[model samples]
Target: MKKLESLPVEELLDQLEVLVDQRDDGKDFLLHSIISIETALLRVIKSDPESDYALSIVKIESDLKEHLVKYGTYLKTEYRKDEISAKSTLKQALRYDQTIPLAHYRLGFIAYKQQAYKSALFHFQHAVEYQRLKPQHKMSLSNQQSYHALLYLSNSALYLAAEAQQQSQKISIHNDVEQTKIDQLTLSPLYKLIDANSSYLAQHAFQITDSEGQRGASWEEYEELIDDATKDALILDMTGREIWVRYGGSAVKLTILNAELLRKLMLNSSETVPLAKTDLSDLFSVQSGDIKIERYVKSISRLREKLRNLKLPLDVIGMVAKPLNGQDTSYYYRSTEILFMLIEYAEGGQ
Candidate 1:
């Protein structure tokens, strides 16, 4: 690659423009473009500092920052199977733009996976703080990342506390005085942080009901009502046969039929539209008869009870006897807060 700085000013601007307009064909293309653009931009900025050019240097810099962040995110997410490479690339991107919360979150996740809890805490804290500082528009990527960061932050704190406690216990066997100091210096502070973040998460994560006592809010109200807690409050992992509720820090096991019913409702759910008896029958491959409705009601009741026992909001699954639609009374997931994984099984699993 010829030194972009050696190229005439006009050619440099043209090349930058072309690179900016280039569609993302693949990771290689993105990586190549990011490197080429960054090399040229940095060189020019250093040498010229101030230049009157056809393409504004400010705009080019902004575009380069975006590309750098994008490539960093790709490396962290898509290429995450190679943990070392992902972390390195993300760190390089942070050197260019430190405000990318997604990069920080990914790095934190990698650190957490490696059991480097302290490093994980640093990155996760940064991700949460930066995400909170940004405006959270409804259903935006920022909002999503904000929720993820907070959850990870809380988990990181929990793990750190556990680690500290273990260390304290080891020290207690040697010197009781040192153990007391360690508990005060480390474990207490970590516990406070974990409690504070967890409280914030539970209060804001999901909006259980609308003003009129409706189960879920519309898109317009979703942004205002929901917060970061919604991300992990409830996770249905079909492949693992796990229903994870945030408050308890454990999975709630359900019968296969009940799990299937919950999964069906979740898959077909709409904020404003509820799935009728006919829909449920089609989904469950059962006859649309009284027995089917009775069975569904019992299954939903059991699911709701399990969720209730876990102290999760009851409105996670909403049922209406008479929806606005002319169909039979129906059921739907009240909020879009629940995370459903391995959805492919919804089509094939029993």
Candidate 2:
């Protein structure tokens, strides 16, 4: 076959059609066919020549997003992080709008990875604000994406605040007891927003008038990365943040794939041992060994084991994954005080 670069998009699409139509069994050729089609798409967008190729840019950007969504499970399974090919992906977004909320979100997240909190805050905040303006105009989208965007913005703000609080002089501790009290309250969403934005004031010693950030993170830059959990949660959310990772467990992930089917079954199951697979899938809405679920569970297991060695409460892990029936959804997961502890552990590398 001709290299993707040597052929036109038309040729590639036709080839993709043939592969899709010819496949007999999904397990046998589905992955191969999809991978080939994707590779072709990537090659075409790998670079751009002189001329305004607006069509090319649009196609490539869309392709990148589709790939992310379609293969999120697979990518997540193999890598701890999404590990997107950011250089090319960001270039497309940057070519369009520097202030685009989605663009800002990506940039800010990228910045977060680089430990550039200053830059990350700038990007994340703008992403939230710009996205707030998005409207259906005439018709509503099937999934009003702006809602998720808003949540992400709120979450980012909290994280930014948490980062600042961990630093000195951001907020006067007054005493150890007060600090612990503040930490406890910070677990709530309202406090998280306050703390996250308050970091801006605290960051530069700009006369700390409030407890945390007053304004919040910026959406124009994504350039901050730090490894501090307590603030990461307290600053970003009221209850705390639950990180979903790719823990690489096939059986566990399968349960997640059958989440709905299993949930129905769990409705009738009894007090579980270790946790009935159906019962767990129903509770977490994360069927089997989803990477995110795996990360969460393993993180919890690691926490419990450590507590045992150190002689801390063992039920702490249960506290984190209490599995509230109401909270079972794709948007968020339920957690207890121990979830915060796990986040802290992940941060401290313990």
Q: Write the per-residue lDDT of candidate 1 for residues 165-276, one digit (tens) a residue.
A: 8777766776435444555554666677767755654443332322223132233333332233435445554332232333335456554445556666765676687777
Clashes of each: 1, 50
lDDT of 2 by residue, 1-350 (tens): 56666776567657755553343111222433454565555566455454243345554444444333322223322234333534344434444445445555555555655767667667656756665565322111112233333444555556666666555334555564335445544436656565654454234221111123122222222012112322322111111112221111101122212222222222222223123233343222111222244433443344334334423222322231344553322112122232221111111100
Q: All candidates' TM-scores?
A: 0.46, 0.33
Window of ten residues with lowest summed lDDT in model 2: 341-350
Report the C-alpha displacement of residue 218, candidate 1, in angstroms. 24
Q: Which ten residues in a row have the lowest lDDT in candidate 1?
A: 341-350
Name the top TM-score candidate. 1
lDDT of each: 0.54, 0.37
Give the clashing pairs for model 1.
205-230
